[model samples]
Structures are given as structure tokens and as C-alpha cells.
Target: MGSPDPLEWDFSCPDWEQRLRDQRSLLPDLPLDEVEASRAVSIFDRLRLPDVPGQPAFADAAGDWARDMVRAIFGSLVDGERMVPELFELVPKKNAKTTNGAAIMVVALLMNLRPRAEFVLVGPTQEIADLAFQQASGIIDADPDGYLQKRFQVQEHVKTIVDRTNNARLKVKTFDLKVATGAKPAGVLIDELHLMAGMPHAARVIGQLRGGMIANPEAFLIFITTQSDEPPAGAFKAELDYARAVRDGRIPQGRVLPMLYEFPEAMQIAEEKPWRDPACWPMVLPNLGRSITVDRLKKEFRAAREKGEAEERRWASQHLNIEIGLALHSDRWIGADLWPRAVDVTLSYAELIARSEVIVAGIDGGGLDDLMGLGLIGRCRETKNWLGWGHAWAQPEVFDKRKEIAARLQDFADEGDLTVCEDPTEDIRGLADIIEELNTLGLLPAENAVGLDPQGVGALIDELSGRGIAEAQMIGIAQGFRLSSAVWGLERKLKDGTFVHAPQALMNWCVGNAKTEQRGNAVLITKQTAGKAKIDPLIAMFNAVSLMGRNPVAEGDNNGGLDRYLERLSA
Candidate 1:
């Protein structure tokens, strides 16, 4: 129940080898029942490899380090009870994770003491579920003495293996919240957790699966996954963070064991970049010679680097398990790298409005085939930091024409960050309505606060004025080199951590798509340079920041000054 003992790591660590040794030494030394652990390993070892030429022993095919890891996991105990109720194993691709997971499930089924118990293996897709089931079924059929055949009945059609003596069964299933609704599982295995991170129902399904464990004290849950190429988000990131906390002894283990096969913190941040070095590859690769070879990795890495920067970064993320920062394009805006660090999920629209003395609106009216974006930026009364929120609207016809980005647009629509309106004209009205609502809330300034592109906003200006917004409030923000100061200010705010925004997926995507161009000594982000990608939301942010730089609200008197300004406008 206490925090982990102080770590022996510091930035001054001499080399990666020393940091790695220190990390391995920090693993918790819980009470372990050697007898039970050996028995579990014996069951696992008896399961034959399905794919090998002669169907070699699972122990031999899994390699020594993997076998030992399995032994340590199953054998560990606390007060003579199961010490690890949950286990997380994060490794790179082609590491024999699927086969190893199947073996672990078989061992778990054989070791369960409770009669009529149910064990489940959940995969992100049906194909993956079937693959694991085939591996488990093959293991059961490979028993030479008919020990497993006589003890258990394999039902391939239903993907279940039932122990005849105890009436216990192990089943493979794809992620489904309804299937897990009332099922009580003695043990659960989640495969490719990163694939499910983007699923809207992933959290609910996982909660249901783990919730059934209350009746069984010895129940176990295991997660096996590879790093995602996209940004780490949702449940996968949350679980990974907690596992790391427990691994480092920063938090109590609490029946959880984390085996993370990744670079140490110090080595990961090394000036010489040890993680990128071929010599350090073996440090993170426990199953190096068996599942993967350094020669193949080196060859593949060389080819990937030659292809392009994005390909190289993707290869490193998948093969090396290194989390590269978020950048969609190679020539991305300078602020794109720091965008992830500026996210404050707790900053809601209502909270931002309440805390700020004044709010400015920014609009980017992208063409018929692109998104129309509206953004709000406010300066916090106490902290003086800028808080932002944005949403985009697109006509359904745009998706019909732009088939390439249609799926991505649909995903943003599903997340509530983007809206697909029936008519293109509705987007302008929608944005005008938002401004009127904020103005009624007394957050928006009565004049000179809404900044937008001057060229194509005659209709928009009329709509805003109809909604009680003064004509003087709609200021024209010059495009190209003239707006360089705004771009530079936004970059400075991001780097200084003086800017924060709610996690808006649409905005994140737009920012990632932005590419910069230099005009004389100034920098500019233009849609023409961004190609087919939509950077409307990010452009809207820049427009809002440009207006906010004018400081429409007086200093030192945050609330009363804004109230008096609004009162004089109304009179």
C-alpha cells in the first residue's frame, strides 16, 4: 500500500547498460511459491508449437527468457496467494506474442481450481480471435499420450475448449461489450490492446470483463500489445501509464505486474541517442535471436530510413517501441511538436468562458470542398495563459467528392469534433449562432473581436450583424506575411506552456496537416501549401490569436472592465 522505494536512476547515469541493470534490479521481489510456479511452467512447456517443422516443445520454441518470464509471472505469490491478478506485456511486432498468449491461456485453464470456471481470450478483430483459437486447439491435439484429449473436449466451431472433468471452459472472442455483460471469467487475455484504443466501446467492454473478477480471488487478466504508430490515447495509454508507475515502484504493485520491454528513461533521452544504436537493440529485445534477428532489423531499418522520414519514424515506433512525437507531415508547423504537451482535457468550454475576462472568435471559411472552422481563444484572468476550443463543419457533398479523406472526416464526426451539415450554407449560419451565443453569455467583446479572412465574408458579416453582433466587431486578419507575428506568438505560447486547449481531435488533425512557408524573414502557414489536407481549424486559431494580441480588455481590472465595456455598448 505504500509508494515504491526511491529509484536509483538519475540523468547523470554513465551508460544505457548501467541504467538497464538498475531498472531490472528494481523489479518487485514478492513472495513466490516455487512449486506452483514450476507446475505452471510444466503445463506451458507440454504445449507443442503448432507451426514448427517437427512441432518442437513450446519451451524450446519460446526461448529461455520468455520461458523464464512466464515462470516468474505464474509462480509469484503474496501471502501464499496469487500475487499478480493483472499482467501487462508490451513488446514489438513478430515476437511470437500470439503463440505465447495461447500457451498462457492453456496453462491458466489447466491450473484453475474452481469448477465450471470460464476463461476468455479477447482480440481486437475476429481474425485475430480465430488465430489464437487455432493455436490453442492445435496445442490440445498435439498431446501424444492423449492426456489432454481425454481430459478436455475441443470445440472448434464455437472456439472453446472444455475440461470434461471440471466442466471448465476456455473461449476465444472478439471484443464485444454485450458478450461480457454478465459473464464471470476466471481469467481473461486481451490481445493487441493498442488496436482497441480508438474504439468507442473499448473502455466499457474492458470494465465489464474485469468487473466479473470480484467473485474469484485468483482471477487474472493479461494484456499483450505492440506500440501504436498513432498518438497514444484512450484506455491503452491510461493502462500503460499505471503499469509504468507500478513498474518503477512509484505506486504500489497491488496485484499487478508490468513487464515493459522498452528503453530506459535515461537511455531514451540520451544526447548520443543510445536507443537508436544497434548495440543497444539487444537490451530491449528479450527474444532477439529466436523471434527476431538484429541483421533483419538493421536491413529493414536502413531501407525504411531511405524511403522517407515518416516511414523511418513509423519503423522505429513499431520495431523499436520508441514513442515518436506527433507530426503528420515532415514540413509541419513548429508548434505541431509541442501541441500534445499543451492539451488540458479538464478545460471545458463553460470553464474557459467563466475564467476569462474576454473571448475572441476566429473564422476560416474554407472552400466548398473543405471544412469551415470556428475557434474561440480567451486569455485567463489570473494565469494570463491562452485557452482555446474549436469545431469544424463540412458539407456532406465534400465527402462525396473527396473519397480519400472521407473516412478520417467520418471519424472526427463520430468524436463530436466535426459536424457534417446537409448544406454548405448551414456552416456559416452555425458559426454565426455560436458567436451570438457566446456574445449573449458576455464572454465575446461587443466590437473588434471577431477576426476572419476579409476576401469572402460579405455574407458572413451580414449574418453576424443580424445576430446582434456589431459590424465593427468583424475585423479583417491579413493573410500571408502580414500574419507572421500571430504565428510566432502562438509558437512562443506553446513552447512556454502558456497556451492550453481541450483535446479536440479535429484541431489536432488540422494542426498536424499544416505546413509552413517562409515569406521574406516571416513564416506563413497556407492551405495552398498544405495541398489537399484541411488546416482550417488551425488557421482559425491563428486568426483568433491575431485579434487577442490587440488586448481588447484592460489590464489589472479583469472582470469589471469587461462588464462596463459591455454595458456601454448595450446603452
Candidate 2:
């Protein structure tokens, strides 16, 4: 169904009708209350706070979605019974997105009639997470009840809050896998969601929320953020993807309310005078004249353009709503608008391997403390798609068990597949237990095997070489197998069914914890910080790079460890 035309709805929707009813009730049926009307008018007239107005006078005070969002929150509290369970508001950055998010969070915390309302604020990182904390605290301080300190008990980190009344709690924290595992939250608000795509840990944490959400039937999940200038991933991308589907009417229900403030891809930055795109002023920024200044935008735009910072330019135009990289970054590898769902192919892994003529395996190793990943690929004879044969990962800490890992390697070798292990480490005595097991299984006979060390795994190389393993190198394939390349490749394959993996939880963890950097060319794997107080992405990359190696395969065949299956098919 197409979205109702702006004119047809008559604003009879429950939320709209309720707002009108509220407005009517707020005003008396008597002679005009100049004082009340004037106060409302001042809200629109006075842009800044303090001297700023209290409430919006007209319904058009903000963009439709923005207004609708405010109404949704207001209705959820005061209107009570009629509130929707979920509110997805996607607006580009600098469009007062954060300010609006902060406002809703404040309302949820203060107005709920419950003795203590629970609220959770999540950010992609600690600093990003603190934005909501800072904004909410400021709003409460300005309230009359001394609410900042007296009403809500703020704790060591902004993540925790206690209600002075019922000892109810409100909290804020960065998206970490462990923090939210079994959390029973009443309301969840995510900020700077675009950054979530960079880490897999966020996915695990969010998954826990989805399952645990049933406890509070009336709980709300609020996904609010701007566009991602990088390869879209994580919750932000998920929200935007769903919103676009809603806007296009691809989905029957309009669950998500998207209030995007993005400029056209063809916009030009060097159009003589700045603010060249007139269409940009209103669509991209709600605080254009209020919190953000036109001069500030112009100066930043010129600097980014002159410096040829294409990423910065795209970020400014899309996230900040300023026109910058109109000409440069427009040639993106894949446009954000080109989201296509994969066509379901129902062939099982064994069946796929049975029909393939070539097979190849890609091994991504984790650090001594990281995760080691292995992927098997086989060419599907029918669809020609690169069928995902299998995917596996072992914790490096566990792989420290030489004998156990060796047994696992022996299994791969016994299956008669071309098994490729990145340079074995001292974790298990040069993976001796594994090599011996592989030799016993008679996969490559230990004569043709090679160890790869793209970085300087000199000790590993020496040990493997001493053990009589081949000293072959794979610089070309290894270079192409870096984090950025592997992620992009895996994403494409997964989306296209060119790569398939058996259902495994750890595989999903690696996929979700992997975060892409602003470079738009590399990815960062996150790790727990020294204090274990927080997690960082550098640790994952360290482990991912450790898995690089070269493997000898038959010419023109991408045997990512599927040769055994190909031999079966040939037989």
C-alpha cells in the first residue's frame, strides 16, 4: 500500500486526533487567552532556549516525522493506552536529531506516572553514549523540581540512575555485548547508531534485548540516528533499510517513521556562493539557525573541499546536511539507495559441495587471544554462485590446545579437502599436535603445506619451516584477504548466497563484532579494554591479521579447501 498522501489522512489517525484533543483541552472555550497563545507563539518565534519557548504553538513546529515522534512520546505517557510499542525515527544528523532524542528521553524519564520509570540510553561508544546523558541532565536541571540532583539519583557513570522515590533506575552505556546480555530494560534509546555496524558485539547485545523485551509488554525500542557515511551496517543501517521499505510501501505497515535530511547525490559544492543547494537548507537541518550556524557550516565545507577530504565531504553533506562532496564521492561502489535483499536459495552445504568442480578455503586467524576463522567456498554448478560450503571459528585461547586443535585439523584432512591453516603459532608447540594429526589423516602429507606470514611471523615461519612444511607465499591473495577486503567480500557473498555457512552462533559474533572504520577501506575488530571496564575494536583486527597465509591450489581453481568435495563430484 502506498503511504497515504499528505492531504488524504485528514490527520484522523489516533495520534493526530489525540494531539488535537489535547490542544483543545489545553485552551479554554472562552475568550482568547492571550497569555497562553502568546507563550506558544514565543516557542516558535524564539529559537534559542532559556528565553526559548516552552511548547510548540503549531503542529508544524518541526518536520512531520519529528512532530509525530514528539506526539508519539507524549501520547505514550499522557495518552497512555494508545501508544505504539516501537518508534523508529531516522533523520540525518545536524537536523536536531540528537536534540530531539535527548528531549524524548527526558520526557520518558520525568513524566511517566509510574513511581519509577526505567530508561536506558545507548551510544556506539562511551563518548557518543554520553551525548544523551549530557543532554538529558541539562533538560532536568532546567526543570523546577530540582530534578537534576534531587529527583533522579545520578551515579558514577551516566549509565546508572536511581529514582529517589522508588529507587527505580535509569542508565546509559556504550553498546557492549556483555553489559546488555540479560538486561531487563523498560525503554531503550540508541544514538550514533551508524557506528554500530563496525562491531559484532553490538549485534549480540541487541539480540539479547529483542528476546528479553517480552518481559515488559509496553516497552519501547527507539532507534534514532543519522545516515552512515561508511558502508552501512548495524542497527542504524537496519533501521534505515526498514524505513526505506516502509516509505516505498514495500512493507504493508509503516512501523518506522523516517525523517531524512539528505541532499541529492548530484548536488554541487563549488557553485560560486555557498549554500548552493537551496533544497538543502530545510530538509537537512532542523537547527539550521538555532544551534548550528550557517557561517560555521560554510567554513567547514570550504576546508573539507580544499583539503580533498572526500569522506569528510560526504559526511558533512549527508550527516551534517551541508553540501560538500557533490562531485567526488558520488561515484560510490554501491549507492546507499541500492539495497537489494538476497533471493533465497535452498540448497544444503553437502548438496552444494556435491555439484561443485572447484573449492577454496579462506582462513582468517585470531591473535593468541583472538578468534581464528575459517571459510570454505565451492562453485555451484547450477547457479554459478559461490556457495558457502562451511564457516568455522575457534577461540585462540582454546586453540592453545595443540592436541585438540590437531585432532580438528586431522578431521579436515581426513575429509580429503585441501586444508589451509595460516602460519601455526607457538600457542600449541608450533601447532605440532595439529600438523601431526593432519599428516596422519593424509590430507597433504605435510610435504606440500605452506605457512603464511604477511606481517613478521618470523618465529612461526621458522618453526613451521623447521618442521618440513613448504615455504610458499601468497602475497596477492593474502593482501586481498585483509579485513576490509574480506568483510566486503563476505558481505557480498552472504547477501547474494554466493557464500553460505551452517547456522552457528560464533560465526554471527564475528560478523557482528566486525566494525568498518571511516576510511571506508578497512575494518576494526573490537576487544575488551585493560580494565575490562570497556571494549575496544583494535583487538579483533590484531587477531584477524594473524590468520593471513598462502596456500597452493590447482591453477585457475579457487579451492578454499573444497577440493576433496570436487574429487568426490569427479568420482
Candidate 3:
């Protein structure tokens, strides 16, 4: 490979190359003599731009940053003695992130320290991983010189291995429990982590690769994704927490560096001229001007804003990194008129308590690897408006505290609100114990039920019936996925200025963190794609709807009404 003629382009002037050099210097101010500046310059020189049909060309700063990051990653990996895994998690959306990360993976495979290194590119699904593979192959096809094609060989039906003559043998695999069992991955790139749902399974698979990475401590495990859910927990949340710790100096220094690009939690877009909100694109997106045009984003996100759901609007804002009122991904479902400003609410919990004659409580249980949420919804008989109400949360660790849980249940019941609690735990023994304790305390309301997650707790269902708690409902099922009566009810209530929530941090989090997934006949509701999509709210919403005896007529309701459905838990 020969260097391009200096006269051909003006790198001598204040162009991308100079910008790359400046960014490279932003490193911990390490001594220039020791750093591989020449090698860094070389990698930047080879950085290629793929053909994106309509988008503006990548910004120079973005190109420079990508080049600098790749160089730094390589430099860190090559050092045999000083090897630490570095994480590159960014929030930049589709255009810039995917294209850039794909380029980095291709280059890493093409030019690596190990000859025929076994590299794995993993995603939640095969199709997603294939997209990356196609990009890499396209780069080879688009290579001006026949370098990549000549170097790499494709054995017709067999594996398409990278050229061993050079140094890298790249292999790609999607995250599968069965397939990933015994494999040793030299380098692994995880994409769209926001879509991952099951943590324990993912953790086990990732753990298996640890022993294999010993040879090359520089062996990378790169996670690249856009922000989907709020953290303080979950895999992504844990990652965000650690990254923040590193930035804030909470955790003693280590090399698992994190780069987060998100709008601050405080910024809010006004009802009028919401598109003008800058909270959509914070410091995280450097390719704002070039790759992701504001005009294009405005057009794309405009429909989602019409969903008429505050929760959905918050989701569009957080995930798309844009303000509400623009189009949303699920345009028709999310109505824009929902979500009255906070100022509209005049009554506090105290006033609501004084006036509320009837109250119904909904407790969404967070079992192992899930979040438990308690929402106290009160109904005004005259107005038929479910008053904006109180709520609480018990972290996953506290699920075992039956006494405390029962007491809290009793407390809500005494307030004439504890009508139903959804216990979506696989451990029916534990949930039964909580119900038994509540019953013993006489805290159980005259008409109340518990929603059990039927999918995983079938065996325990029979046992619950034998114990006379046959009314425990099975949750995390049916239409409540994302478009349930409960969700729409909440949406309608929010829109019409009726539903009231106490503004608890976790509940707001649960609301903001939720996302929609389309299933064949029914839509599955999920909260934050941690390792895989979690149906915390599916169970929660079922409990909320089933207990209040307030099932709205949505598409997915079965023949059994809410009470009849709960009665069949044991049957």
C-alpha cells in the first residue's frame, strides 16, 4: 500500500488530518515520544468513508474522533504487558454510529496483531450481525485498490475467512446461548445492546469468553449502542453507572473507559415550538451537523409525537435524542395531545386523600432481575377520573422482605387503595408467602387479587389454588404488551388530565424507560433493553388493570373478564 500523493489533497492545511492529530493529542497528555504517533497517523490516513445515499458527508471532527479512537484502541491492545479492556459506548443514532462502528470493525479485522485471529461480531439477532458483515464486505468491494479482495478469500459455500497471508482471520456470530457455549473469542463487538433482554444468560455467555481473552489482554469486548432506557440498574444501567463513576472519580481508576452521549435529565422542551429544544442533541453527538441533519431527524420523529401519550413522548425524546411533537416510530398509537403540563395539577397527595372516597392500589412486582413498582390509583366516582396518585418501589434486593412488603400492602389497603398486586415472580412460594402474610394482617382488601406471571410460574399456579389463593392472576401476558387498555388508559388519563402519579423517580423511570416491540398478533411491552427485553410493566400493567377491575377493551383481552381471569390462575 502506497501513501497518497501529498499534492493530491491539502492535509498540510487545517483539514481533517490536522483535526485528527489534535484529537489524538487529547489523550491523557502522555509523552509524545512514547506514543506510536507514526502508526496513529498511518491508521487515520487509511480511514475510508462508505457511500451513504442522501446524508451529508461525515463531519471532519467526527472522522478525526473515529480515527483517533481506533488508533488509541489499537495502541492499547498491542501493549502486551499493559492491557485493559476499553468500552466505546456512544448514543449517536443510526447514521453515524452504525457506519462508523462498522468501519472500525472491518479495519480491526483487516489489520490485527494476530494472524488469522478469531473475531466475533455479535448482536441480538442474526440479521443485525449480517448487516455489519455486509458493510465489511462492501468495504472490500469498494476498496479502490484490489487490496482487500486480493488479501481475503471467499470459499464458495464454506467460511469466508480473512486473508491469513496478512494477519487476521475474522469470524462473526450473533449472541446465541447454544452456539456461543465453548467458543473462545479473540475480539467481540456487541451491537444494539439496548435490545438485549436476559441478563443471567448473557452474563453466562460473556463469562465463558473470559478465559479465552488471556492471551491477548488487549482482546476487545466493544459495546456500541444508542441509549434506550434510563439506568441506575440493568446491564446498560450498570455500564452507565460505572462510566459515570469513572468520570466523577467515584470508582478507583481502571481502564474500562466509558464515553456517554446523552442529554441531561433536566432539560425540557416547551409545548410551543418543541422542535427548537436543544435537549435532543447534547454533547454526545459530534456528527450533528454532518451525518444526522436536524431537518431529517425532525421529519423522521414527527409522527411519534402524535401518539398522544406522555410516556411515549418522553420515550421519543430520550431515545431519538429529539424533542416531542416530531413524528414518532409508532405514529398512530402515540397521540400528541396527551401529557398536560405539571402546572395543571392543583391537588397534592394530601388533598387527594382528603377528597378520595374510593382508592385502588396496583403493585407491579419486580422479581429476580426485575423492578418492583407500586402505584396507588384512586378513582373519583362522580368524575370517573382516576386521580393523579401516589406510588412506591422496592428494589429487586428487597423482594424477600415479606413482612415489610405485606405491611406496605396493608398500608395501601388501609388507605382503601390496595385492591390488586401483581406478583410476576417465578417463585410462587415467595409471592404466596407475601399474600398469606397480608391476609393474616387483615390488610387484604375485601375485594382484591394478586397477578402471577403465568408464563414461568405455571407449576406454582396449581399450588396457589390448593392454598385457596386461586384468585392470583397470571401477568406479563395478553394485550398489555405495549398497547394494553392499561397503557392506553394511562395515556388517555395523561392526555385528558385525569391520571395522577406521585412523580416517584423509579416510576418516572419506568415510564420513560419503556419501549414498544411488535409481536405477530400482540405487541410486547418492555422496560429498557438491558441484556434482553424485560416485560416488567407487562406484568405490572396486568396487575394494575386486573386489580382495579378496570380492563379497557383493547385487542388482546381473552374471553375471561378480569375477575374470571384471576379466578383461573390455579385452574
Best by TM-score: 1
TM-score of each candidate? 0.69, 0.48, 0.56
TM-score leaderboard ranking: 1, 3, 2
Q: Model 1, range 125-216, lDDT digits (tens) per residue?
A: 99999999988888888887879888989998898999998999999998867658888888889998877766656767878877887677
RMSD of 1: 8.0
Candidate 2 lDDT by residue in tens digits, 1-571: 2332323212112232233223221111112223433433333222222213663322333334444454443443212331344555545565556655665665555444555556678877877767666655655544544535687766755457676766666677777775576677777778766667556455567768766666765567778776655435444445665655554446644544443444433343233433454344444555455546667766666666676545555656464544321123332222111112222236344554455443343333435433333344445556656544333333334335433233233333333321333544433242443333223223332222422324544554565456554544222124322545544554555555454443322232233333334354554323321121111111222222222212222233324435644565579
Q: Could you tally the backbone clashes for each prediction?
A: 1, 26, 32
**What C-alpha lDDT do the candidate models reach, one value each?**
0.77, 0.45, 0.47
lDDT of 1: 0.77
**Which parts of model 3 are misplaced by more than 4 Å?**
1-34, 50-62, 77-84, 154-161, 198-200, 229-241, 268-282, 303-571
Off by over 4 Å in 1: 1-27, 63-69, 76-81, 253-255, 264-274, 327-448, 452-473, 476-510, 513-537, 545-571
lDDT of 3 by residue, 467-552 (tens): 65535232333434533655555666667676554433333333433455556655445443322322343345445655455432
Estimate the overall C-alpha local distance difference test score of candidate 2: 0.45
